[model samples]
Target: MSPRVLIVGLNYSPEHTGIAPYTAGMAQALRESGWDVEVITGLPHYPQWRIHDGYPRTGDPHEVIDGVPVLRVPHPVPHDAGQLRRLGMEIVFGLRAATAPWGRPDAVVVVTPALFASAIVRVRAALTRTPVIAWVHDIYTAGLSETGAAGGPVTHMMRAVEGTFLRSCSGAVVIHDRFADYLRGHMGVAAERITTVRNWTHISEAPTVDTDALRRRFGWGPEDVVVLHTGNMGAKQDLTNVAAAAQVAERTGAPLRFVLVGGGHQRPQLEQLATTTPRFEVLPSVDNDTYAGLLRAADVLLVNERPGLTEMCVPSKLTSYFTADRPVLAAVEAAGPSAAELAAADAGIRVRPGDPEALVEGAMQLHDEWITTGGATHRGGRRYVREVLSRGAAVRSFVSAVAKLLPVTTEHRAPATVNS
Candidate 1:
């Protein structure tokens, strides 16, 4: 009879991507706090657009990871990034929602990777009258259309879908305040019903892998200064700036190596750019464990995004870099949400977005500074993440939000997420 919470999202880990880490961490955190939590999601394959490396499709349809029950239903592997492919994935998961056997939890938390995922949750919630907490990552209608991945009448249609989805929600959680504003100002979601619950990665243990040893395998030298970018290489990230920055490193003999990991629509462009540049190397993504190692391995973690589009999205990669305790060089939209975090954290340097020359100069200078100071030194941001951004803290914030959504129990109130 404990509180049971259901989280629905796409590309959850062992699944890896934006919401994956949050979904996995939140489910485990809620379970740890004595609430029975289950995640209802699609079959493992995303970004790669294939099933997860070792996991196989099963007739049983339900799997468990680290004691948190994962109910995986069928979803299409849409290789073609067309409207049909996108809709195909949403339709399959929406149908699975009806038939998936994860018991109806007292309250449901739906994480939207795509814009239309909310539409599905809205229909289901309306049918059952179940309370739903819609957690907005990036709204697909605006987010993807902004990226040109989803557009035309589809964009208009998605905006309409988002309208109803937000209206149907009992409560809404947005990662950054910009989104909360979007929900209220644009989607007509009431401000009182929305809360800004920041996204963060929770770590139980600090990284144990030897970054030097990792570099050895990846063809980077112990003395090499690494500029690592982890997570999606999407259009919005504007990785060409990273490539331009890498060119500066190569020219200046800065001994800086740019390692691009994770996948996205912009991956091919980054890959093509890297192919012509020796200082930049493309490494296929490893599991979450190896990804953690890469975070710590880099002397400089690059968290850059296109300028002007900052409020539309916040990079989850910043959480990983901050948690790993590495110095960040964020070349993002000026005065964006992430810039605010970087400034407040005093973590690393920030350059104005889209100015390739400025980005290169800033990156080159930061590389020189790191090498001159001590390449391996951790920053205040790392210390801050340890104190504030830990997994326990993140889950507690999410759990409390879920608890609040569950009619104000007035028992076992959880703490909010902090810089740790």
Candidate 2:
């Protein structure tokens, strides 16, 4: 029998955005590589924080996605999720996952962001003598302090708890080197136990579409410069800065349109701001194909974060933006992982976070550069994705890393070459 691995997380396939794609992709890759994989996750409720249609609130908890067995646990679907409420939800899910009927697997991979729940999984793993690998997506304590969601005693307590959880894991896989540093230096995770595997673009080959027709479908004028921001519009995103930049463009007649596409707790606030902000628009999330076409059609892509949010998370949208062959404009801290990624890819431009004037100026600069250079300046992003962010390479690296954490035994199959 093939060695079995269990993946525990809050999100999975069919969500298409944020952490789901990565988790789902990893599970699929592992199964293709000859490992028996199972998933313990929550009901689909992400970017849009309501359970997806067809998934009843109370019903059969088991389903198969992409050929992997997934056991979904019911958790609170908060319409407006505050930090406390989010934590409460995680706790409930973690408790349920800990007691779930998932049989003992040779190894377990716990996805963080569901940090507290992962901690509970660690306790269960300890009891079962099952080695656990932590896949760190975001540092919860850093998020709380960096986004001004919480601080002081609360931040300190969370840091202690999170550190204990990660340190106890058999190993960890992080998307950025900076995350590895945090795990080793701050969280006391041994350096040898952490692996950095950058996330790759999960978007499939985008079908060629007529650019003019695509633009017209979205009501974008030929003369208008569209700066598009996709994915979660959460507190960390600080999309208000994007809205403010739109207002600045409107007042200055800059001909720039800032369009935010996604859902989150902050969407309502951004929509409210868009009511009076003529240059700003808010659109609901689009399907993957439409998302790809929108990315291809836009003049510039954007990554906006609240000021002082240096190291909590790296916006996953960068991967897709790079693949779209468009220059990116990031309003983020100069020292943060997002800015570092932009620099590494030689992709786009970055301005100080929360500065509307600077944001608009940067967007105009990109537009001018695109016109002058005829899109040649943005080739670096595509090259970076091809050379550095290959999906095959990332998945293979993760599988190899997980293989090392498993017990030495002939029952386990060797990791297979990942197909692109």
Candidate 3:
């Protein structure tokens, strides 16, 4: 029989943005790899932080997607999440999901951001003699600290618990080189135990859409230099800098308009800011195809990070942005992973965070450069992503890492049902 694999995370698909798509893609790929894979996750309430309309707020049960069994657990959805409220919700979900009847498995992969629940998974794996892999998407404590959500007795306690969980897991996986270093240096996880499997874009390659038509539809004219930032608008993004830069561009009479295209907890504040800022526009999330088209259509794609976000995690959107073959302008820490990736790929320009002047200057410079060179400088990014960060490459690395931990068997038979 094939090895039965169970995945635990706080997010999963039908939710197109954030960590959900990656988790869904990983699960689907594992199923195709001949593993009997299943997931134990919360009802989708990411980015917006409110449960979707049709799904029950509580007692959400098991459902199957593309042949993978998903066991949904109940958890509170925080409308306006602060540190304490977010921690509380994650704890609730972790407890409920830990006790969920997910059945026996040869191995389990617990996804982080669900770090509040890592302890339960550790203990359960220990008792059941099942190996567990911590598939880390972010360095949780570092992320919390960088996002201004850490530094308290609660944070101290949680950090200790998280470290313990990391050490206890059979192995861990991180998405960036910086993440691997953070795990080793900050969390004190042994260097040999962590594997860096870079994230792949969940958005597939689709035929290009009518760029001219969409530009006109969104009120962009030939003279308007559109700078688009697409994806989750969360605290980590520091989008206030974008608004400030828009103001700067306006005051200087630069032919620039900044559009933030996505939704999240921070969207309402950005929306309020847009009401008074003429050069700033906020649009809701689009379907995957439209998202791809918008990426292709924009004159410049922006990746703006909060000031202190050095290396907590790599923004998953960068993969898609690179794949779109657009010039990226990242306002992030100079030595950070995002900037480093841009430097390595020669994909885009980077400036320090919180400098609206720098942002305006960078945008104007990139715009001029694009026109002069006809985007020759930005062509290498897509080739880099296709060669290094493709979907098949990532999943194969993930499978190889976990395969070492689980029992090796040759029989490839049907997956056993949970109740069996």
Candidate 4:
């Protein structure tokens, strides 16, 4: 009989943006791989902090989606939540999840960003005699401190809590080398216990479409340079820099049109900012397939991070940008993981996070390169992603990491090929 694996995470699909889709995909992949995979996640409330339509705050704790069993727990939903509110929600969810009627599993995989919940899962795994893997998306304490939310006296406490939880886990997986180093150096985790499993492009493939017609549908013309920033328009994304860059470009008679596509607590602010600039536009989030189409249609793909987010995150947007086969203009820390990854992949251009002038300059340069090279420079992004961050490679690595936690029979070693 195959071993049963329980995945504990705050976000999972039906929620399109952030880490939700990735978690869902990972779960599905594991199921296809012959593991009896089960998930425990909260009601889907993410970039737009309200719970998704049809999923009530109070309802059945169990549901089946795409053939996998999901155990949903009710947690507080915070619309436009701040650090304290977010923290409270996490705690509530953790408390509920700890008491969930999860049957025995061979092992557990806890996804962080629900840092408190990971601790609960660790305790549960200890009691059940099950090995646990802390699959870390972002280094919570360091990231929260950098964001100024859990700074000052609480920062040390946060780190201590995170350290204790991670140490308690049988093994861990980090998305970046920097994160692994932080875990080892700051949290005192042994080097051998941590595995670096980078994220892949969540969107399956860039659908072939008529670029000109799609641009026209969005009111973009041949002369207009479409620069797009897709995904959650949340506080962590310093999207105001896109508006500022568009302002700077207009002053220089550049034909740049900045498009912010997605919704979040910051949506209204972004809309107000867009109102001041004719060249700036804001649109609601589209389905993943439509988003992939937009990526293929846009002239330039943009990524902006709030300043001081150096080690906080490795913006999942870059993986999609690389897969989009479009030129990228990133406004992020020069030494940050996103910057280094883009540079190493030879994916696209980068500038300091907060500088509007530099952003505009990078935009213009990429636009010029697009016109001159006919987007050959941008097309390199697709090849880079395929070679380095292929979805198959990521799934293989993930399964390998999980298998090491417990012995798997040779018959169960091979994972099904995931086309999505």
Q: Which candidate should be chosen as best, given TM-score against the real structure? A: 2
- Per-residue lDDT tens digits for candidate 4, residues 1-420, read 677788889999898877887788888888877788888889987777888889887756777777678888898888876777888888888888778876667788999978987887778778878899999998888777876776578999889988988988889988889999889999999998888888888885747566667788888888888889988887678888889888988888888899988878888999999889878999887777778888888888999988878787787888888888788888888878888888877778988888988988888898898779866675666777788777788789888888888865533432222110
Instruction: Rank the models by lDDT, top first.
Output: 2, 3, 4, 1
Give RMSD (Å) of candidate 1 vs. truth. 5.0
* Prediction 2 TM-score vs. true: 0.96
lDDT of 3 by residue, 266-315 (tens): 99999999999979999987878888888888889999999978878788
- All candidates' lDDT scores? 0.73, 0.88, 0.84, 0.82
What's the lDDT for residue 50 in model 2? 85
lDDT of 2 by residue, 1-420 (tens): 577898999998789899999999989888887888889999888888888888886977878788788888888878876987888999899999899876658889999888989999889999989999999999889998997888689999989999988888899999999999888888999999999898999764464666678899989998999999999989888898898898899889999999999899889889999898898999998888888888988999999999998889988999999998888999999999999999999899999999999999999999999899887785688788888898888988898888897767746444322110
Worst 10 residues of 3 by lDDT: 411-420
TM-score of 1: 0.88
Cα misplacement distance, residue 64 of candidate 2 (Å): 1.4
Error of 3 at 415 (Å): 1.8
Q: How well is each residue in 260-316 modelled by candidate 1, as lDDT tens digits?
A: 887766677778988898688767767766788878777778887876665567778
Distance from true position, residue 97, model 3, in Å?
A: 1.1
Highest lDDT: which candidate?
2
TM-score of each: 0.88, 0.96, 0.95, 0.94
Q: How many backbone clashes does candidate 4 have?
A: 0
